[model samples]
Target: MSTSAPEDFAQALAQRLGGQSVRQLAAVSGWGRTTVSDIRAGRHIPSEAQLRDLLMSVGADESEIASWQERRSAIITPPAA
Candidate 1:
């Protein structure tokens, strides 16, 4: 994966969030707005558990959650030599 993978992941997540604001997502996910903002901005990449919690808080279906997990995995896992 390229260096921009995290940004791409964040952009896709933001799109999935649609019109929801960072504050609203934070309230629903029990996370601070700054955390949400950082995730959305690609300044922070949440752990698997944190990502699952955020996705579940937004009522993400299993397939959607899986897709996000795959994306997150792609970012964290390096390409095989």
Candidate 2:
């Protein structure tokens, strides 16, 4: 992983889904080469529900998103670190 923060990750996703060259989109989004390649190859951007469902279907943990959401909320509400 590139150690990009969660906020950057969110912004990258937003911009990639926004208007831009698909190739440039990967660089801007800070995604791994493989991830970008796979996405471009048509791995659909899964919705939160779909992702959660998929995680459960595959017997993987899905609690991390909740933890991330909590951390994001704290960052939003608290004084800057």
lDDT of 1 by residue, 1-81 (tens): 575888888888877776778888889888889998888787899888768768887789889898899999999999999
When superposed on Cα atoms, how far off is each prediction in RMSD?
Answer: 2.5, 11.5
Off by over 4 Å in 2: 1-42, 64-81
Worst 10 residues of 2 by lDDT: 50-59
RMSD of 2: 11.5
Error of 1 at 40 (Å): 0.8
TM-score of every candidate: 0.84, 0.27
Error of 2 at 80 (Å): 14
C-alpha positional error of residue 60 in candidate 1 after TM-score superposition, expressed in Å: 1.2
The best candidate in terms of lDDT: 1
User: In model 1, how large is the Cα lDDT of residue 56?
Assistant: 82
